[model samples]
Target: MKIHQLQALVASAETGSIRAAARSLGISQAAVTRSLRELEAAEQLPLLIRAPEGISFTEYGKTLLTHARLVLNQLEHAQNDLARFRGRAEGRLSVGVTPWITLTFLAETVLLFRKRMPDIQLELFESLMAVAQPLLRAGDMDFVIGQLHPSTATQEFSCEPVLNYETAVMVRRGHPRQHCRSVHELLDQDWALNFAPDGQDALIEYLFTRHGAQIEASRIVRAQSLGTLQMLVERADMCTWCPTVLQTAPLFQGQLVALALNEKFDSRQLSIVTRRNSTLGGAARCFIECLLQVIRKHARSARKEDLALFDTLTLLV
Candidate 1:
């Protein structure tokens, strides 16, 4: 199919109607309609369902939209590559990042990357792998720097280990169960779970299961965002399972503390995850390099007791 036809499809999907799509693309409504009709005829499938409210994608249309997004994104990368080769620093780099990176090293990495490629626009999405996977597959995001569990680290993406750190059951200081020493002790306490209950099992749930216990359904609070989770723990007297490193963040310092539990979880690796077999643009590559350098710098300055956390600093690039 032609590039404009794919563009029309994507625009229509985003804008929700032919006229809106045409307006966004700076083309006439008739031209957008013709493109969509031609695309449907070429594919021999009905891609859109027209209605009084707006247009909606058919099953076939949803399937093709993913590929269309990838094609358009790759074209943008190619153009950016050419621009960078000509020594012009301009393009957008979208990334999905977990909270730990933002709390620790993301600011330094951004500063370093900016000094080098000052004109490249950056879009940072605070997202977990479960939320980011589809966006990465559709080319709506370039890469994700987040925790990658083995179960979800499929072959569709390349996961390069960056830092290894542990998790903790955290709560506000002086909570009733702050002195509790086991995962079992906290089963009766209220919990703030940041992940979707229907998706992959949450870390907190796994810990409870490992201890041969289960949290009651009624005692759990679903926290849709990091801020909400933190607030729930600090103000609502709810406990949460999170990266141990988060205790070092400015927002959590003194406001929250990890429970002294006897159980220890295996280290969770922070990774720079990207699509396999995809070519990263110059700006993206440079930003990754900046991240690695900042990580190495952190490793160099860390105390002796903290060196073990940075042990997996092997360059997987």
Candidate 2:
């Protein structure tokens, strides 16, 4: 079968629909159908079983899909290697990011990279961690930056720890609960939670339940957008858990305050991730190095701040 036909088969299998596969491949539906038909005829087997809901792959189709993925991966590697050898670090690099980091560091990273590598194009997709992981494995994204859980670490992907931030309760300045130093004292307050199937909210839920505190399900306002959540916290008495990066956000200038948790809760680890076996081009490698440098700089600044705080405490004593 032709490479295009094989690619169509693989895309259709992954997406579970000809229309979606066609859209992802940037081709017409008719063309995709024609390619599938050609492949089926050449192989003399029914690759897909059409159903009312969507398409399902047959046994042969399943086997072929495994081979298709390997072939496509090798082809992509060859292309990347050739581009590198030609001294043209030019190809579309897709990146996945979380909402919090998008507001905190994504823009800065993109701007800095663009200034350095004007020829390299970038496509960014933002979503929750669950969605980002699958896309990264499917060759949809060259790399991703966000919270990395233990279950997400697999043989195909490698994660590098970038930074860790404590989850703190955030409220608007002058909040009545801001004076409270205990988690129990703030439990009655309404919370704006990031509502996702698998996200920080679930982790918070586990932590509360483990401590014999039941989270008020009704009081949890679901928010998928950080900006929207920040607005809610700014305008109302609602509070939410956030990382320290939000403290530097300009949206809620002099309005937001992060309350320390009474007992130390889990800290989220931000990680930079890429395919374990995939070879990165020069541009991607340089960009990664720059990101690591920025992280180091932030860490050094944090150490200096801590030293200053210690000095002030000594003088007060």
Candidate 3:
């Protein structure tokens, strides 16, 4: 009912215990216990199961926690908006970005954003759309600029395409199959892919459909992080289909090489993804504008450095 009551519940859930929640909230343990009891009494349902180890949410508590997070985040956004209108640029902005953006324009965007809103707390997470979706839905992250998964439903979010995501099969520099020109020639080798749960089948289909080569799932390794996929490709014969931007990052400078297959994979887009119908706060809006400015600036340049690194980038902006 009350805002503080909701905050108490959320803090308890996040911190995992009553005493920890009380400490985070700058309140006494007894007050935290009282708020939890009051919330439970108001809802006429048990919200938390307190134990010596920690506090665990009941199913009811789990459901309410989601809404509680949304409510709290929205309230913070309202406060931030008011502060911005009063010429006070101070608020927290949480955003998720894929690896390519970091290698390309994120540094420029951050510098631009910080100059305008120096007091705003910026939190950046290196995440794929699959990893960032739940946080966006729960209002834990303000937005994400990453590749959108075609197989995943996005009716709950708004995705605005910014750049076309080009990909290629990559392997270690001296791997035996590195010179293979056809997908069929590499089917027998191990494959490591970094993709969403539903995106694996689609990527696999794209990689092999041209050659009509069917790959067994047993030969494929599902990678959760870019580091893991990089390790697999660099240390072993495992090959990966990833953003062509990897070829430009210093981390992969000489260790990895893209296979020049005659076939091309399906096109994906890098988009600015945010919750549907949600108004972005001041810090979030300013950061997105900075990101777009960098993208547009680079897209218009004909410098040799830009051409070599961003040749495959086709901007939708």
Candidate 4:
């Protein structure tokens, strides 16, 4: 029930060791143990089970940890509110974003935000939409900017569409399949998949399977970072499906090109997801305004280049 006890619980669970949790919280090891004991004593239940390897959370421990994070996040927000009321420095704003959003609007937004709100701290986490969903739900993030599939965009979250675009095949310039027009030609080649979203993988599987390639079982290189993905595609024969906007990535440096595939990829809808019915703080709203502004500006700025790139990306079919 105590805030420090909840903080200890979260820190211990995340760090996987009581000593490490104490170090993270800048408290003594005994304090961490005492906090955990207090938590369990109040609930009259075992929260964590210790073992030779490390401690593992019990079912109740996991549940409490989830709430603990939520409570901590709420407290942080409250602190931010109070700080601003007292004319102190603005508070921290944590956001979860997808790579597409990162490569598209995030940098510009950060730059603009810093120019306007110099005191506000910004934290950015980039991952797949699926990975960010749990982080947002657990209150680790103020908002999430990512692609939203219809099936995964549940009613629990409110989704506001920011960008809508289909994906395209990305490859190094002068690759053999540039103008080949056949999906089959590229099937046997190794690939880089940045994220394994539900329908995203299925579309690739369906196409390869339908093309008499039977390559659905073949493992594609999974690249977690944009630079790695680009490096793999540029230095090797690997290809990837990516947003056409990715052409703007610094790693591409005009070395990579977006090719039109013979078939199609599922539609990709980029949106901002927030807890459904949650009120947005003034700072959060301001951040969204900056983000949307950047999105629009990037779209406008990329229009001419995208048109040129789209015209060049072609499959013989």
What is the C-alpha local distance difference test score of candidate 2? 0.71
Clashing pairs in 3: none
lDDT of 4 by residue, 168-273 (tens): 7878888877776767778678888755445446655655666565564465877767667777888887888777766765546487777766676665666778
Candidate 4 structure lDDT: 0.75
For model 2, where is the 10-residue window of minimal lDDT? Answer: 308-317
lDDT per prediction?
0.82, 0.71, 0.85, 0.75
lDDT for model 1 comes to: 0.82
Can you tell me which runs of candidate 1 are displaced by over 4 Å? 200-205, 302-317
Q: Put down candidate 3 lDDT per residue, 62-81, tens digits, no spaces.
A: 99998899889989999998
Residue 205 of model 2, lDDT score: 61
Top-TM-score candidate index: 1
RMSD in order of candidates: 2.6, 5.9, 2.2, 4.8
- Residue 264 C-alpha lDDT in model 1: 75
Clashes of 3: 0
Q: Ten-residue segment with the worst summed lDDT in candidate 1? A: 308-317
lDDT of 1 by residue, 1-317 (tens): 99999999999999999999999999999999999999999999999999999999999999999889988888999999899889897999998988767876789999999999999999998876667777898899999997765666676778888777777888899898888999888877888875644653565457787777787777777776788888889888998888877776666767777887888777677788888877788888998999989878777766653364344333333
Full candidate order by TM-score, most accurate first: 1, 3, 4, 2
Sort every candidate by lDDT, greatest first: 3, 1, 4, 2
